[model samples]
Target: MSFRALLWALGLLVAALFAASLLIGPAGLSPSDSLAALIAGRGEAAALVMREIRLPRAILGALVGASLGLSGAALQGYLRNPLAEPGLIGVSSSAALGAVIALQTGLAGAFALALPLMALAGALIAVLILLGLAGPRGGALTLILAGIALSALAGALTSLVLNLSPNPYAAAEIVFWMMGSLTDRSFTHVWLALPLTLIGWALILPLVRGLDALTLGEDAAAALGVRLARLRVTLVVGVAACVGAGVAVAGAIGFVGLIVPHLLRPLVGARPGRLLPASALGGAALLLAADIAVRLIVPERDLKLGVLTAIVGAPLFLHLIYKTRAAQ
Candidate 1:
């Protein structure tokens, strides 16, 4: 298909999924009524559901998914690593660790920005440490190994926090939050995440040209006038905001980043810059659909959104690994 057609299809899919999200809750409202409630603030119950619940959820799903997708594409494109994802690189896990600490230590409850701020700090720390461990000139093998070590360390620390929690309810809450879900989220979360996520996007979007140049290799990209140090800083801070804010509100939703960009890569002719917006829209659509599926799959059970994504993403990831090995 043509590029225009592809954009149109993705736009339509996102629009449809956004509508589905607003309408698919337990409230039993029709699409028309839900849209009406969202747009015109008509009817009490519908208005409450639309304004207070589903609207924020849908908006967040869009923002978070876009952030993940955009970050994943940026990372993969810049590093030239097919498997570079937020979770794989320790960003998500590190952010999760911080948020868990905040929750366990009662810092989150004491301050509204505690979770996101800590999560952001954790992400920044991960990026700094990863860069130090692997260096800016590290190969894919070195990067992956360093990332694995960091992820393990973050995971271990997060578990330690959970294990040491004196309050059983807090421990349970930590576990549930780690599992990840968007259920019953409010506008407070929406507002908390929006500014940071947007800032991240703004920071990363301009690096597309640099990302494209880097495809020719660091030296070649530098010859082309791409500033590697500045680009790296932009990417690190930008990804921290995106992944950190996302983990802050959504609690570790994984693979929207990993899967969305890969799926859209070919459609965008594998161009890094072209892939960003496409991946963002694709991520939003995929996440909204997944969130809807979890809601319907076990309405009473309330399946975690992260569970479904992991189930689908893990095997696909394994397949990619196999394919990469076979090609080698």
Candidate 2:
């Protein structure tokens, strides 16, 4: 299929899934009821279901998924490693730790800014640590090792914090949040993270050309007039902003970043420049579908988004690893 045709098809699929999300919640409103509530502006219960519940979840899913996809694409392009991902590099874990700290300290409860600020700080710290460990001339293996070290440290800290919490409710909340779900999210979350995600996308979109250049190697990119130092700073900040806000809201949902970009790469002809936007759309669609599936599969139980994504993503990851090893 032509690129345009595939884009159109994905667009339609996203719309259909979104509509299904609205209609098929625990409340189980039909399409007619949803439409009537939307059109007449009545049915307080239906309106509550659509407006106060599912709509925000859907919007947040799209935003979070888009952010993950774009950040993943940028990282893979910048690092020249197709396996590079936000979660693998400890960025998401660090962000989640930051948000968890904010929540546990009662700081985030007082105001809306605490969670996002701390999450961004955590992601920045992770990136700085990775850069220091890997150094300027480090190869793909060095970077991967650095990322693994950082991820382990962050995970240990998160566990320690949860273990020591005085409030059992807070600890339980932290554990559930870490598992990651979009259930019962309010519009407050949508408003809190949307601006930051938008700014992140703006920064990364311009870097697509830089990424394409870098794919030819850092020296080639520099020779081609790409300012390597400046591009690296911009890419790091962009990923931190996007992924931090996402982790702050949704709490470390993985594999959207890893799987979306990898799956869409071929569709975009394997060009990083073309792959970025396609990954954004594809990721949005994938998360929306997953969110709907969670609602349908078990309406009573709280189905974690991260669990669903992991179920789908783990096999794909293993296959990619095998392919990489075989090629080597």
How do all models score by TM-score? 0.93, 0.94
Against the true structure, whose lDDT is highest?
1
> Per-residue CA lDDT of candidate 2, range 1-328, in tens?
6778877877787788777777777676778888888667579999887888888998888888888888888888777777778887788889988988887888899988888878888988987777677664445677778878877887778877876889776656655555577888889998878877888898888987888887788889899999989988988888898888988898887788889988888887788977787777887888888888888888788888888888888788778778877877
- For candidate 1, the per-residue lDDT at 311 reads 88
lDDT of 1 by residue, 78-101 (tens): 777777788777888899898888
Q: Distance (Å) between predicted and true CA of 154, model 1?
A: 1.9
Q: Candidate 1 — which pairs collide?
A: none
| TM-score, model 1 to reference | 0.93
Runs off by more than 4 Å, candidate 2? 135-138
Candidate 1, superposed: residue stretches over 4 Å from native: none
Specify the poorest-scoring 10-residue window by lDDT in model 2. 170-179
